[model samples]
Target: MITKYKLYFLTLVVSLLLLGCASKQNFIDKSKSITKETYTYHTFENKNKLQLDFYQSINYKNTKPLILYVHGGGFSGGARDENYIKNYCSKMAKNGFAVASISYRLTMKKLGFGCNTEASLKKEAFIKASEDISYATKYLIDNKKKFNIDTTKIILVGSSAGAEAILNLAYVYENKILAKEFKYAGVIAMAGAITSIEKISTKRAIPTLLFHGTKDKLVPYNVAPHHYCKKNKKGYLQLYGSKAIANKLKELNTSYNLYTIQNGNHSWNSKPMFVYFREMISFIDHQVLQSKYQQKEVVKKISDYTSTDL
Candidate 1:
């Protein structure tokens, strides 16, 4: 009887060991699917705090890079993880990047752009929107240790109005404007425009990759006074068309790249969208931040002045 009892105990111990091994293997398998995480963040509406849902990619391996996304709704309305960005975000996250889709305050016309003449008030709200994005990113960074992530290597992605916020976040940090806490390696902007083109044309931060369409009727292909803001003449926004803007960047000698989708709509998500993002992820994996190239023509004013002195 004593011998039989000992054997039973030994068999139980072996079974427990096998279960432990299975758990370890399961962990290894999950590490490969970090992009499947989705989460929500909190902010305020009229001084009252509220929760805003965002889809966050799970970091199974704890090593997947991160990309923070801000969805566009003309600066007024849009969910953080719209279906448009959902699949793409998942594809990116699953491939090895933790992605977050964020929500921000909308404009008065965004079911609420009131008739208040206080443009500053409206702009302030926009500023708040940017703040929310910054905070969300910072939250991720602060918890990097818990997540086993490289907090320093982060990519910011946005579309349309959200792109505006991301660009502003990049360029305005020096001005102490938005997202002062996070680090960004690069940017992927789709149909984005800066609030102040003069500011953007004169200075920039990280390398920005842009994708825009010629017939885009929303953000316009150019700056104000010519933005496609008005369908009648395709108004002034045409100045932002990738080619025109690329020329400007060329003149500025900023290290940037562009892919102008022929007659591409405001945000084209069809052609191998996943594939395009994957390629960019690889690019970000290897690129280092550096001084942007200034085009002789764009910076010719400064160069000309220096040359005259010479």
Candidate 2:
């Protein structure tokens, strides 16, 4: 026995809920329509092989932006073909970008060692992963004509351990001679961190988008030893999380966006992939594709400031 006004209010609430559901379902349908192409991108001398799976929209009209996605599994497990990753990449592809999901060497075999050995192995793994990503990027750029990739619009997206790798790839490895031919458009790190803030220099900084749950235990939301190992532990690798890296970027006057998920955990991919994907696409559109920050301008500013002070 509801009043007419009460019944009207209830009807409006139900209508909104139904509309929300319809919208979400439409998004899912759009993601499902993207087409994918797979290729073996690289192989190592050790017989370890890495591959890339590319996703693009059927209606893509021009050279598409590139998203090189790295999967996460504690630097040990995970593959480029993981359904969640594939689906996420497909969704991004549907949004008019070419998404490449890549596989890299993992180091779970050497995990049980004491602190020093563990830390050393972890460091080696990070380096290897970063190197692999560099190779993957090179592979794409070298064959951009075949893949229809816009070389100037490459983005790195990684999750957890993969996140760590891409952050190092973007900030650490890019600073080296090995990446001389590479130019990153932006980096998106999900539950990721870096070995040191010192690795990130003002001149080498790129637009960054970060997503971290404050309660992430494995990867610190702030700063901590890799895997949250105790300070006195033998294998403790110092790592700086999104907040720390963002602060450093702020000091350098670099463009960066940090989204801190309240009470969020490390299993971000477990949630509906599109939720974050939408935000990520927005970041890419605004920060990378439409960004006003240019490499030449940054270098010029640094040069001018140095001369003025001198």
Candidate 3:
């Protein structure tokens, strides 16, 4: 015969297990309203391959705008199809947009991005990743007709290291890789920063949406060293995070939106991807597609998640 105490303990264990499952579900949207296809974008000298996973609405139509997403992994490790990213991409596809998650060279995989790593090597990783982004864009543009993509409306989206690469491509780096006239429609950076705010002149600025945590230590919320490496360290490269980038855009009279998560941390990199999906779509539609010029700043406490997030 089972004792009353044993029965109560078993019931409690079951309850906790159910709650755990529910919390996991909250992180990703599981709707199946999208279609996905994978394509090889590049082949390296060693015969290794880089690919992109494209997502679109199941009720597909032509000339849809694309959200070219780059995954965050601190330049060392990350994949194009992380679950959270797929969830976000699926949600966007359902809302009448196409999404592409691409694979790029992880140059910093061997040497971690820390105080011990050389700053120049870190910068090279950025350049190499951005170059891959450019090549991915070229592949999509070349196959625009087949993919039914509006090449002109391709917005760049990234998380963490991915964010840094896209930001660098948008502001600091010249397009010596792609067509001279080619330009990204907009930029959505999640916990991203740039090397130089000076490159964000009137001629180079674009519609940008930035999401960052005020207390982010890995990627500064304002101007600070990358990973907060000490000045005496070789990897002490200063970065201009979301706040600084938005300020630069403001100075240039450019369209930009800055979402500051108070007391949040590096985790904000992926959280905003799902939590602020509506806001992201709004920015893309109004700021990028419609070419509306609007500058706005929003701040919310981390505790706000209890009332707002899924």
Using lDDT as the measure, the top candidate is 3
- Give the Å error, residue 146, model 3: 1.0
TM-score sort, best first: 3, 2, 1
Q: TM-score of predicted model 3?
A: 0.89
Residue-level lDDT tens digits of model 2 in 74-158: 7768788876676677656655678899988776545742354568787778888898888888889889998888898899889
| lDDT of each residue in 108-167, candidate 3, tens digit only | 999999989999999999899999999899999999988888898999999999999999
TM-score of 1: 0.65
Quote the lDDT for 220 in model 3. Answer: 98
Return the clash pairs for model 2, or none: 115-234, 115-235
Q: What lDDT is reached at residue 236 by model 2?
A: 85
lDDT of 1 by residue, 1-310 (tens): 5453244334434533543443222433443444344444554556744233333344244454567877777666777655556665655554445666766656544333333224354455556666777777766776777555566667788777776677666654343422445457778777765545445554464566666655666555455422323434321222233355556666676666676655656654233244255346434543422233422211112122232222
Ranking by lDDT: 3, 2, 1
Of candidates 3 and 2, the better by TM-score: 3
Clashes of each: 32, 2, 0
